[model samples]
Target: MQFLVKSARPETLKTATLVVAIGEGRKLGAAARALDAASEGTLSALLKRGDLAGKPGQTLLLQGLAGVKAERILLVGCGKERELSERSYRKVAAAALAVLKTLGGSDAALTLGELMVKGRDAYAKARLLVEVLADGGYVFDRFKGDKAEAPALTRITLLAEDTDLLACERGAAHAQAIASGMAFARDLGNLPPNLCHPSFLADEAKALAKGNKALKVEVLDEKKLKELGMGAFLAVAQGSEQPPRLIVLDYKGGKKDDAPFVLVGKGITFDTGGISLKPGLGMDEMKYDMCGAASVLGTFRALVELGLPINVVGLLACAENMPSGGATRPGDIVTTMSGQTVEILNTDAEGRLVLCDTLTYAERYKPQAVIDIATLTGACIVALGSHTSGLMGNHDGLIRQVLKAGETAADRAWQLPLFDEYQEQLDSPFADIANIGGPKAGTITAACFLSRFAKKFHWAHLDIAGTAWVSGGKDKGATGRPVPLLTQYLLDRCQ
Candidate 1:
């Protein structure tokens, strides 16, 4: 899809469709008022006749209004004029785009970017508008025999004032990059396990680096992993016929000497809980197990596109945890690259096993900070539901920075306590620590397990088990979360 910035009155812009906002109390915003007057109070008359109520998410479509050049007009409810929050404004934008999608128009001009959102600037408004459009416009029918026709709404023009045009353009560009990154992540997560294995992930990473001078890709096979003493990570891969991979992506866009921000991801391409096998029910959704890794690659895709002036390294601990004779079983112990021993009381607790080894590897970078993303525990889903990623970290300052990034991006994270008390649950008499920290505070314990390996750097962990993907319903697919948050954090630092 294409995006543009238009600096003109809504009624004067010639387009297939014109989108404007109406407040809940039947009050029209500036653009809507101008168009309404041009059409001799057509919007007001329709509201009075009960044809349209300006409730949030409510939309009305009118064709060939008296004085409008556009073939159609879409009126989206923005809730109360005085109470138009950012969230509500997003809803308004979504509603407007929904109408445009069904109109079969080639393009449309939206003036909703002019609407005032509390504490949000014109750039943010424009960015959110295009971001919503790109997200909503996503279609994943590649596997469908009877695929739907391509959407007719291909180009979108966001109306903004002359003074705000540059910011709007910048915001739109960033939003497109982010949305494309999200789409990339979702595509990787939604691929069938048969298709998106460890090798496939490595290939994808290499493909991403192709022709991109700013990015470099490297992959480590089973032999290389063993040479590096990643026994914990190798244990998970031994069960799968497809070998494991430690995928590294180096994005060098900053000053030559700057210490890079390192990101580690647990890439359990298809986790069947290893020998401690998960129930058959919902096991198919395990394809999303690698979403953490997908997010890292996705963030790189965006950062490279934005040409962000910040060094970043993505370390993906890619492997498959299948239940086979070779699979690491309960009561097994494996040593990590850090030479730290971990008791594998349950094979299903393998994400941390993969991450522990990789986290230790990350210290070699001497990074400014290291953040690992993983769908590490179901307990995180139970605690935070599917809306927010569970955040835990050893460094309060880095944790707060990530939390703030999540907030700014609306890809939020709720910080769970990383208190030393939670670390006690990970104690093991047999080894340096145990992989599973018994069931209580399971998410924190998982983070605690990784914290031990990340002590050398400013580190934070995002347990995205809940927010990574949906398990059922029509919307069941990868959400491509935290990419927005992670990207925003890097972007902020670049500034």
Candidate 2:
């Protein structure tokens, strides 16, 4: 959708829809009061008649109000004037856009950006408004034979004051980039496993680099992986006919001497739990197993779009896990690239296996910091549910940075303990470690297993299993999460 910023009177703006906020107890926001005055107490009369309660997410649509220039007016509820917050503001914007989508309007002028959200400036408000509206309009009907009709709302204009116009414009641009990145991630995650395999991801990396002078792409096939002694990664891919790939994307936008931030992703395109197969129920959602890989690519798309001056490297540990004759079985031991042996007590625990080898490889870059994203364990879902990503790391500073980034982006994470005590969960008498750390604290143990390989540099892990995608219902698809968090982190770094 096209986004524009204008510093104009709400009633004077000629658009298909004019969106304004109404707080509880019949409080009218700045734009709402102006529009109400122009319409001769139309809003007040409706409120007095109890037409709307102004509760959060409540929306009321009116057409051809007396003195308004717009064809329609959309009143979005903002629970309380003093209680309006970042989260509530997003909900209000989303509710407004959701109504706009069903209307006949092709364009809308939103004054919801003018709502006072504590600690949020005009730029932040505008950015969030665009993000929410764009996200609300997203549809994944690519595979549907009978595609649904597209929504009429195609353009959104953020009404801002003269002093805030420039900042709002910048925010709109940033949000557009982020929305593009999210759409890319969502599309990759939504693709069927049959089409979005390890090789397909490598091709996507190459495609993303095409015509982008500052970016370089490289892919390592099975032979190269074997030569590099990535036994742990290979063991996971051995069962699948689709060969494994180690895809590396380098973006050189900063000084050559500066150390880059490395991001490693577990690109298990389709995980069937290998020899320790998962139950058939809800197995279709395994296609989202590679959301970490998708998020990496998505972040790159946003970075390149913004042309941020920073050196960053993305590592995609792409592989598929299936239960085949060649699949690594229980009680098998494989030596990782770090020369640490891992016992495969449960083939289902494969994400860490791929990430361990990739993290070991990241040491070659001498990175300033490394953060790996993965759908590593189901235990993360049990602990954090679908709301937050589980975070763990060896360095407190890096962990705090990630945690703060998630907060800034509103894609929050809860830090799980990575104390030395948890390392015992992965202890194996036969090998340096065990892939499965029993059942308790599965998320922390998985991070503990990776922590051993990342000791050379400051490292953190995002276990996105819980927040990567929805499991069922009408909203069952990729959320394209933590891309906002990751992008925000990098954006903060550039400053």
Candidate 3:
């Protein structure tokens, strides 16, 4: 979708439709006195009942205002004025797009622009809401046989007639980059895992890197994996005929030799639980296992698009864990790219296997800090629920940065403990450590296992297992999450 900003009067807009967020009692911020006279009671009576101003995410539509040029007006609620924050207002923007899904118009305007943001500047707030509307408007029905053509939504004009509006304009460019990148992320996640296997994902990364002067990408195949002693990661790929791939994407917008921020993502295209096997009940959702990789790849593309003044390198470890005789079985011992042997007690505990070796590869970069996201454990869902992700890390500063970023992006996360005691559960009698670290605090032990390979650098782990795929049917699957959070965080705090 294209976005534009103009100083045209709301009455002068000759588009097929207009969208403005309003309240329940027809309460509205005066649009600088002039339009107020022409609008008359249209704004007032609309707010009289079923007004769009009652709360965030609430919306009502008004047709043919007395003297307005637009045919229809989309009134979206912004909640109480005092209660509106940047995040809340972003929700309002997202709600606006959601309400417009079936409206059949091409151009729209958000005249109801105001900020509920604090601490962050007007630039950041404006950038955030525009980005939110772009991200939330995504719809994925790729293979649906019977689907309506998506409505033609070409432009969203955010009105900036107020005093602090310059900040919103300043944020507009960055917001454009964010929304474009997120739309790319949504496409990656929505593609069928079969069509988007390991090699395909590597090709996509390479294609993206090839187009940019500031970025470079490399794809490593099985032979390279063998040379690196990535037995643990390879063990999970044994069952698939489709070759395993390690994709590394590097963005250099900083000092030529500066150590970069490293990001790692788990790329399990289709996980059949290998030899351990999962019940057939909800197995279809496993396609989202690669959400972490999609997020990382999406962030990489976005950073390059935004031309961020920071150096970053991203690694996506791709493999398909299936059930074949060649697959690693329970009780097998395999060493990682870091040269640490891990006992495979459960084939289903495979995500860390990929992430551990990938983390090991990040060490070669000598990064300033490292952060990895994965659909690592179900226990995270049990602990934090679907609303938030579980965060655990050895470095407090890194984790705090991630948590703060999450809050700013509106994709929240709760920090979970990484106690020394959690490491004990992974201890193996026969090898250096065990892959499946029993039942208690499964999420922490998984982080502990990855920590074994992520030595020295400030590193943080996000267990997005629960938040990656929303099984509730109410929410769209693969939240296209942590992409916005990770990207926004790096843009803000990584400098």
**What local distance difference test score does each model get?**
0.90, 0.91, 0.81
lDDT of 1 at 382: 95
Model 2 quality (TM-score): 0.98
lDDT of 2 by residue, 1-495 (tens): 999999999998999999888888778888888888998998788878877788999988888678889998888889876857788888898788878988988899999877888777888888888989887778899999999898888899999999999999989998899988899999999999999999999999999999999999999999999999999999999999999999999999999999999999889999999999999999999999999999999999999999999999999999999998898999999999989899999999999999999999999999999999999889999999999999999889998999999987889999999888988888899998988778889999989999999999999999999999988999899998879999999988999
Task: Give the per-residue Cα lDDT of candidate 3 at 283.
Answer: 85
Report the lDDT tens digits of candidate 1 across residue range 143-247: 999998888888999888899999999989999999999999999999999999999999999999999999999999888999999999998888889899999
Stretches of candidate 2 off by over 4 Å are: none
How would you encode candidate 3's per-residue C-alpha lDDT over 282-386 as one tens digit per residue?
A: 787888888899888888877887888889998999999899878889999998877789899999999999999999899889998999999999899888889
What would you estimate as the lDDT of candidate 2?
Answer: 0.91
Q: Which candidate is the best by lDDT?
A: 2
lDDT of 3 at 74: 73
Rank by lDDT (best first): 2, 1, 3
lDDT of 1 at 491: 89
